[model samples]
Target: MRAMAYRGPYKVRVEDRDMPCIEHPNDAIVKVSLAAICGSDLHLYHGMMPDTRVGHTFGHEFVGSVHEVGPSVQNLKPGDRVMVPFNVYCGSCYFCARGLYSNCHNVNANATAVGGIYGYSHTCGGYDGGQGEYVRVPFADVGPALIPEWMHEEDAVLLTDAVATGYFGAQLADIAEGDTVVVFGAGPIGLFAAQSSWLMGAGRVIVVDHLEYRLEKARTLAHAEVYNFAEYDDIVVELKKATDYLGADVAIDAVGAEADGNLLQHVTSAKFKLQGGSPVALNWAIDAVRKGGTISIMGAYGPMFSAVKFGDALNKGLTLRMNQCPVKRQWPRLFEHVRNGYLTPREIVTHRVPLEHIAEGYHLFSSKLDGCIKTLVLPHAG
Candidate 1:
């Protein structure tokens, strides 16, 4: 098997590796048919995530066919086409029973925070991801579902992470009817969040980003107002002005560690690694949202401390909600939305690269070149 190998920061290559076999009674070996290079994967590529070991493949959003299943895997058989959620968890645990699949206690040894995530760093349970030709899926019966016959494979693959997480971000916002929602970041997740806000009855949706292409996507795909944070002297103040000086009713931060606005924050967190992640987006959320409003955080951040505006959030009585998305939990409604033509997740996909050219794929996405929005990695293609 050929897998994406991480040699160091800003370095990765396709290398031949041993194929994964079922290691647990409940495990399944999935022959990856479609996989995506998520924005979150860039954290590992840039050495932002802790314990991202060399030779560990980095990918989480993937859909594939079951190559083999272990003795206890009864729900799926060989050749079953399935979409696996990013979460690796046991369904019967307390958290899982409560629909907090991302925090399942029975999967990761370090489940004090997030549960096991495919292809994330060791802090996320050290499981190999599906960027390779094959991947080992633990608790296969619980985490994967059969891809709907009506769904495109591209949509199914994005559902494994970006699409699901974006919808979850909107859900976490608790947007009321007629609420004005502002989303920070115009990445796939942010675009989805902005689009989902409209479905949730938001009167207006605003997407903030520094990129012109992504903002253009927000205007066209999401049908939301767009703001380039780089153009504004103070984006927070501008957001307040847009909301008639009261601030937006809800704000979602979809930019995590690599947010670039404050020079010092980005320098310290992203460059020097002094903090867990830059809290610029979150702080902007706190400042841009109205008092007593809700703020949803869907961005991936390190476990370390960040210089966030906790005091302002408390003072303004803001509801702060954040967690690693429980991907499977958002699927039912999402499936309905996709079926009704309300969402076209594949529309966000800008590039598709063969398995052999995945290093170039990573470079394209990481560098934000070629108007890249979302990139899909084809593990089995020429």
Candidate 2:
């Protein structure tokens, strides 16, 4: 079978690799119907993740058909379609018992912890990911949920990542009725975060990003106000102006670089920092936050160590809750959102490419061109 393997740092190639088989009783085999590229996958490509070396199949968000399941997998069968949860938890761990499935003691616990994850790393369970013809899914019975009857496979793909991350972001921010919220980054995660914030009763939701196209999408589709970081010399001023001189009650960082740094300098002063950008979302939120606001950092943090100005954190008395999306905990509820037609996170998908054209897709998406918010890869469509 052919898999898009990381032949080297930033060098991805489509190559023949062994097809995966069920190696554990709790495992299930998914025939790759569709898989979407994620922001985290970029970390691996840039060689920022641990042991993200040659030959790793890179992808975690997927909606696929179950072609086989082990005997122990009762709820799921060969014919049932499901969305693979990004996190694999045994549902009985110290963390899982408390509903903190992201920190599952079994699969993908933390680097300072123990866990497993598909195609992530040995530190993340070193399990094979779903970027190939067939990939094994661990903890299948407990992890893989049937795609709700009203959901389409492409649309349900968000349940595997972006939408879940969005819900996770708003939940962390403690958004409530009549609260004004701000989301930095208009990419898929940020877009979803804005939608989720509005759904959670936020009085107003504002999305900040440089892309005019993205900002338009946020306003027209997600129905949120947008701030063009590129146009405004000071985004804080611009965002505050939109929010009555005060800041938003909650600020969610969906762009995961130096916390929200973009490619170019001067779009944000922090973006041009020679001292180094450190989750500018922290600084952006601090600058544009109401006195007692909440900051939620849910973007993928790479290994390169950096620092944020916590002085603002102390002064603002902001409640900082940071974590990767514990998809295990957010999936069920997000699916509920999908079922009600309250949220359609997949609407951000701008590119749907055959797996073989991943190189082209990656280039187009990495460039953020033509309003390519997200790209879905169909590995077995060939």
Candidate with best TM-score? 1
TM-score, candidate 2, is 0.91
lDDT per residue (tens digit) for residues 250-271 in model 1: 9998988763333356544332
- The digit string of per-residue lDDT tens for model 2 on 99-134 reads 777777766534655455667755676666777777
Candidate 2 — which pairs collide? 107-116, 108-115, 108-116, 109-115, 116-124, 116-125, 117-124, 258-279, 259-279
Q: What overall lDDT goes with each candidate model?
A: 0.89, 0.76
- The estimated TM-scores of all candidates read 0.96, 0.91
Report the CA-based lDDT of candidate 2 relative to the real structure.
0.76
Query: With candidate 1 superimposed using the best TM-score fit, by how many Å does residue 158's alpha carbon deviate from the native?
Result: 0.7
